[model samples]
Target: MDLVERLFAGDKRACARLISHVENNVNGVNEDLKKIYKETGKAYVIGITGPPGSGKSTLTDKLVKLLRKEDKKIGIIAVDPTSPFTGGAILGDRVRMGDLNTDSGVFIRSMGARGHLGGLSDATSAAVTVLDAYGCEYIFLETVGVGQSEVEVMKSADTTLMVMVPGLGDDIQAIKAGVMEIGNVFAVNKSDRDGAKRTKREIDMMLDFSKKDWRPSVTLVSAIKDENVDVLLEKIFEHRDYLLESNLYHLERKANVKNEILSLVRKEIMERVINNDEKHQLLEDLSHKVALRIENPYTASEIIINELKK
Candidate 1:
C-alpha cells in the first residue's frame, strides 16, 4: 500500500517504520514525504519547550492522559541531547513518558539532537510530517532551550507553549527574550515550588508591556499532582480556535511548507555539489590556498561559483 493510505489506516507499526526511515535520512522517504505533502497541515501541531528540569516531560505525560480521555489520537516527539559517542539521548525522555506509550491512541518518539544547533534533531520536521499524515489530531513536540533555531517549532505548530518554573536562576530570564516571543501560551510548571506565584507575576508584567493584540495568558500547573492541567487543556483548545478565527493558522502553515521546501532544496544541492569530483577538488585546493595565504576566500568563492555554473 502507499505511504499516505498506510499511515491513515492507523498502522502503528507502519508509522514507527516510517519514522525510523526519516530519522535515518533514507533517500526513499524524501520522495515519500513529497508525495504526502498535501496530506499534512491537518494535524494541530503544538510545541512544549522550556529549560532543563522544568517538568516538561511530566507535564507532557499528564497532557497525553487528558487528550487520550477525549479520545484524541496524539503524537509526541521529544528532542533530547545526544551522547557524542553513542548518539543516544542523554535524558531518556521516552522512558520518562512511558505511561503514554502503552496507549494505542498515543505514539511517542524520542530523538537525539545529533548536534543540531536548535536543541532539535535535524529530522524533526520530517518526523512531524509523518505524524501529521498519520491522522494524529494533536501532535506535541518537546524541546529544551530557546535557541534561535528552536523557533522553527513555531512555524510547524498552531500554538507554541513555553514551559517554565519558579526557580532556575538567570536561565529563566535568559530564555524569556527568545521563548517568550514565540509562546502562544505560558505554562508555569512545578507550581508547588516556593516562588511559583512570583514567577507568574513576572510573566504577567512582561506580557503587559507587549503591544500584540493577542494576550498569551499564564497558567500555573503542578504536573506531579496534575493540578490545573484541565485548565491548560482548555486554553490549548481555545488557542486553536483563536488561530482559526484569526485566519493565522492557514497562513502559518503555508509559510512552514515554503520554508521546508527551500531548506530541503538547499541541503540537497549542497550535498550534490560537495560530492562532485571537480567541486571537491576545487574546495580542497581552496583550503590549501587559504592555509598558505596564496589566495583569499572572497576570490576563491567566485571561482567555485563560476565553475559550478558551467
Candidate 2:
C-alpha cells in the first residue's frame, strides 16, 4: 500500500511522513494531498495565539491533556520564531512537549514562522490538512505569538483562543483591535500573578462594546499550577457548542474554505509568474525600471500579466 493508504489505515509513521513532505515541499506531495483532501474538514481547528512569553504552549499542553481524557485524537502545529541565520525554528518540538510523545493520541509538529506575518508558517494549513485526513478529532494551531498580526489565525481556526498574561499592558492595547476581536475565547493565563482580574476586566470591557453574537469568554487560569484549566476547557467547549448550536460552524467553514482556496490560487499564480524561465529576464527589466522610477510598478505588472494572457 502507498503512503496515503497507510495514512488511512492509521499508520502514525505515514502520517508523520506526509506532514514532513508538506513542510519540506517534497515533489508530488501536493498530489498526495489532493488524494486525501476529501478526508479533511472533519477535524475542528483551534488557534491559540498571543504575545511572546505568554505561556501559550503550556496552555496548549494542558488543553491537550484534557482532550486526551475523552480519547480524542489531537494534532498540534506549534509555530515558533525562526532563527535568522539558520532559518529554522528556535525551539525544538520535543523540548516543548516532551511528555506528550508517548501518547499515540497526540501528534505534535513544530514549525518555523519562516517570516510569515500572520504568526503561522506557509506549511501550517497543509500540515493541519494532513492531520485531519489522518483522523485527528481536534487540531491545535499555536501561533508564533507575534502581536497584532496574529489575527490571521482566525482564518484557519474553527475557534480562536487569544492568550493573555497578567502584565503587558502595551501588548494588550496593540492587539485590541486585531486579535482581540477575532478570538472566540480569551484566556488570561498566569492568573496566579497579580493583575489577573484587571486583565480579564479589560477583555470583558472590550467584548461588551463589540457586542458580538458569540461573546468571547475571558477566563483566568494558571497553566503551571493547573488552576482553572478545566474551566478554561469548559469555556472553549462552550464557544464550540455555540458555534455548532447556532449553525455558525458550517457557515464559518464555508468562509474558511473559500479563503483557503483563494489564497492557494494567488500563491500558485505568483509562483508561476516568478518561476517562469521565459519571464526571468523580463522580470529583471521590470524590476530595474521600477527601481529607477522610470516606469511605475502598476504598468510593469500589467505588462507581465498581459504576457501571461498571451
Candidate 3:
C-alpha cells in the first residue's frame, strides 16, 4: 500500500516516514500532503512552550499518561534545540519520555530546530497535519524552551500553554512582553519550589493589564511529582470547550491555514533566490553594489525581486 493508505491503516512506521519526509522537505511531499489534507482537522493541537529548564518534558510525560487513561490516540512532536556543530538535537526529549515508547496508543517524534529561530522546526505544522490524518485524537507540540521573540507557537496551537518555574530571578521580567502574551493557559511548574506563589502572582498581575475577551488561567503544578496535573488538564479542556462554544476554534483554524500558506510562499521565494544560478549571481552582485555604496539595499532588493518576476 502507498504511504497515505498505510497511514490511514494505522501503520506507525508509515506515519514516522511521512513525518521525516515533511521535515526534510523531500520532493513531492507537498503533493502527498494535499492528497490527505481533507483527512486532517480531527485532532486538537496543543502547544507547550517556555524558557529552558522549565520541566516541559516532564509535564508532557505526565499529561500523556493522563491522556492515555481516556483511550485517546496521541501524537507528540518534541522540538529540540539543534547543536551548532553537529546540527542535531541535544538532550533528546525521547529519553525522558521513554516509558511511553511501549504504548501503542502514543506516537512520539523528536525534531531538531535546525537553526529556525521561532522555537520550532519549519516542518512542525506539516508534521501536525500528518499525525492528525493518521487518526490521532490529540496532538501535543512541545517547542524548544525559548526566550523573547520565539512566540510562533501562538499562531499554530488551538490552546497554547506557557510553562514557567520559580526562583529564576529576572527571567520572568525578560519574557513578560513576548512569551506571556501567547498563553491561553499558564502553568507554574515545580510548584513546590520556593517562589511558585510569587511567580503565579506575577503572571496574574501581568495578565490583568490585558483587555482580551478571555482571561488566561494560571495553575500551579509539580510535574515531577505529578501533582495537580489533572487540574491542569481540566484547564486545557476548559479552554478547548471555550474555543468551540464561542466559535473561535474555526476562526483560529482559518488563521492557521493562512499563516501556513504565507510561510510556504516565503520559503519558496527564498529557495528560488538562493538555489537558481542566475538569481544567486544577482544576489552576490547586489551585495557588492550595496557594500560599495553604488546602490542602496532597498533598491538592490527591488532589482532582485523584479528579476525573479522575469
Candidate 4:
C-alpha cells in the first residue's frame, strides 16, 4: 500500500515518513497531501505557545498523559528552534516528552523552525493534516517558545493556549497585542513559582478590556508537578465545545484554510522569484535602485509584479 493508505491504516512509520517529506519539501509531497486532504478535518487541533522558559514542553507532556487516560489517540508536533550552524532543532522537545515515546496511542514529532519566525515550521499545517487523516482524535501543535510574533498558531489551531509562567517581570507588558488576541485559553504554568498570583491578576486586568462573547479563561497549573492540569484540560474542552456549539467550528476551519492557502501562495511566489534567473536579476536591480533611493519599495514591488504577470 502507498504512504497515504498506510497512514490511513494507522501505520506510525507512514505518518513519520510523510511528515519528513513535507518538512524537507521533497518532490510530490504536495500531491501526496492532496490525496489525503479529504480525510483530514476530523482531529481537534490545540496550539501551545509562549516565550522561552515557559515550560510549554512540560505542559504538553502532562497534557498528553491526561489525554491518554481518556483513550484519545494523540499526535504532537513540537516545533523547536533551528541551530544556526547545523540547521537542526536546537532544543529537542521530543526529549522532554520522552515518556510518550513508548505509547502506541501517542505519535510525537519534533520539527526545526528552519528560520520561520512564526515559531512554527513551514510544514506544520501539512504535518497536522497527515495526523488528522491518520485518525488522531487530538493533535497538539507546540510552538518553539519564540515570543509574540508566534501568534501564527491562530491560523492553524482550533483552540490556542497562551502558556505563561510567573517571575517573568512585566509579563503582561511582554505579551504583544497579536499574541493576546489569539489566545482562546490562558495557562499560568509553573504556578508554584513566586508571583504566580500576580501574573494571573495581571492577565485578568488585561483581559477585562475585551468584550468578546466568549471570555478566555486563565488557569494556574504546575506542569512539572502535574498539578491542576486536569482543570486546564477541562478548559480546553470547554473552548472546543464552545466552538462546536456556537457553530464557529466550521467558520474557524474556513479561515484556517484561507490562511494556509495565502501562506502557500506567498511561499510559491517567493520561490519563483528566487529560482528564475531573469526574475532574480530584476530583483537585484530593483534592490539596487531602492538602495540608491532611485525607486521606492512600493514602485519596485509594482514593477516586480508586472514582471511576474509577464
Using lDDT as the measure, the top candidate is: 3
lDDT of each prediction vs. the true structure?
0.82, 0.86, 0.91, 0.90
Number of backbone clashes in candidate 2 = 0
Ranking by lDDT: 3, 4, 2, 1
lDDT of 1 at 118: 62
Tens-digit lDDT track of model 2 for 182-256: 889999999988888888888788778875687788999998888899998898899889999987999998888
Ranking by TM-score: 3, 2, 4, 1
Regions more than 4 Å wrong, model 3: 170-175
Which residue segments of model 2 deviate by more than 4 Å?
84-86, 170-175
Candidate 4 — which residues are off by over 4 angstroms?
84-86, 171-176
What lDDT, from 0 to 1, does candidate 2 have? 0.86
Candidate 3: clashing pairs of residues: none
TM-score of 4: 0.94
**For each candidate, how many residue pairs have backbone atoms clashing (under 3 Å)?**
0, 0, 0, 0
Per-residue error for 149 in candidate 2, Å, reads: 2.2
Task: Predict model 1's lDDT versus the native.
Answer: 0.82
Candidate 3 at 127: error in angstroms? 0.3
Q: What lDDT tens digits, residue by residue, belong to model 4 across residues 130-203?
A: 99998899999999886556689888999999998887768557444777678899999989889998899888
Residue-wise C-alpha lDDT for candidate 3, range 1-310, written one tens digit per residue: 9999999999999999999999999999999899899989999999999988898888999999999999999999999899888896674788779899899999999999988889898999999999998999999999998887688998888999999998766535823578878999999999998989998988888888789988989999999999999999999999999999998999998998999999999999999999999899999998998999999999998998999898
Which pairs of residues clash in candidate 1, taking residues 3 or more apart in a chain or in different chains?
Answer: none
Summarize candidate 1's per-residue lDDT along 1-310 as a digit string, tens digits: 8655687787887888889899888769888888777887678888888877788888889988998888998999998888777776565787667778788888998887887766577788899988988888889998855543467667667788888888755435734566668888989998988989888888888888889878888999999899999999888888988988987878877888798789788777676669898788889999899889999999988888788778
Better of 2 and 4 by TM-score: 2
**3 or 4, which is superior by lDDT?**
3
